[model samples]
Target: MDVKLTEEEKIKVLNSDDIYGIMQKILLRESKIDQNREHFWVIGLENNHRILFIELISLGTVNKTLAEPMEVFSFALQKRAVKIILCHNHPSGELRPSEGDKDITDKLIQVGIIVNTEVLDHLIISTKSYLSFADTGLLSELKKSTKYIPQYVLEERLKKQATEIANKKKTVEIAKEFKRNGVDNETIALSTGLSIEEVEKLRVRKR
Candidate 1:
């Protein structure tokens, strides 16, 4: 944990891949300390992806840990983290996500929305391998509320915005074609879904 970093020791995390690599090392180091029951860890990061802190949320039994959203988020909230990554160890060496794993991820994602913190991803760690919720499409299936949008949701919205812009450009072209064929501004508006003023501007351009 770079929590002890001085002002001169600023470590910038470039992206999710960077965090995943860092998390693997952190989990492996923690593994040496305890090889028994499961441990849930919460890692907080600033908007620029700088590490704020890493904390243990709960130490669970063989298969389960009671994790409340409030407890999971308490530290991140205190540190003013804009995003968080959830990491937990599986004693059984199974990389698969358990029911409890799924439950906490869902709960935390919703809690993040309410508190203005976004849950970027959840990682299931084992000594041999790791499973990423973002990689497996589970992160995409999380229930989102109107109150908050997670990073993955924001990426999706950006994609839609690009498509909408392309469609509007196509509509404008169609309107020009209509005008070229002697179509009225009212008719062009109806056919291309452009405003009457937009059609008039195109007509003036053609003239």
Candidate 2:
């Protein structure tokens, strides 16, 4: 890496791991001077995952920063970047991500999917240590989560859940009808796939 990484040099070869290495150095140097203020940055990458540019998205108080997906992606779009890596400092020297950190990462990833600018990773940085969502498997967990899944996958999952819920409701209705007749709790439980306790509750509700 040159003292000032030439654009040609940057584009010739660089992966996320390489960028992570570079950021480690840069962040270490910067952190020595001001470790009390949080800073958020977005690194724009070419389609090949080479560095296009790094932009500071926002600066905030000691513990938190305000970063918006729109603003982050707007810069990426302006630079014609096809991918981005998000990085932020904790200032409190905490490398562990907060709930707010994960929330924003999920939101940015969703935005990136919509805009065709893929989110590569989110790094939580401190002077002494750092956490990579990509490396630690948190990003993978988020992708697998029903709450943070891509829109298409989530919609399909929701449809399946709705069908399952409807089936359960119908079973409950049938159980109610059985109870109203003369079916015992044990028989109603077996017929409706519900517990005896649930059948008892349904019977009590009728009375």
Kindly list the per-residue Cα lDDT of model 1 for residues 1-207, writing each as its tens digit: 232334432356665566556655655665554656787888888998787887787877776767778887888988898998888878788888977678778878888877889888888876667788987888888754333456787788889999999999999988887787788889889888888998888843444
| Weakest lDDT window of 10 consecutive positions for candidate 2 | 1-10
TM-score of each model, paired residue for residue: 0.64, 0.64
Error of 2 at 128 (Å): 2.8
Candidate 2 wrong stretches, greater than 4 Å: 1-17, 28-33, 148-153, 156-207
| Alpha-carbon local distance difference test for all models | 0.76, 0.78
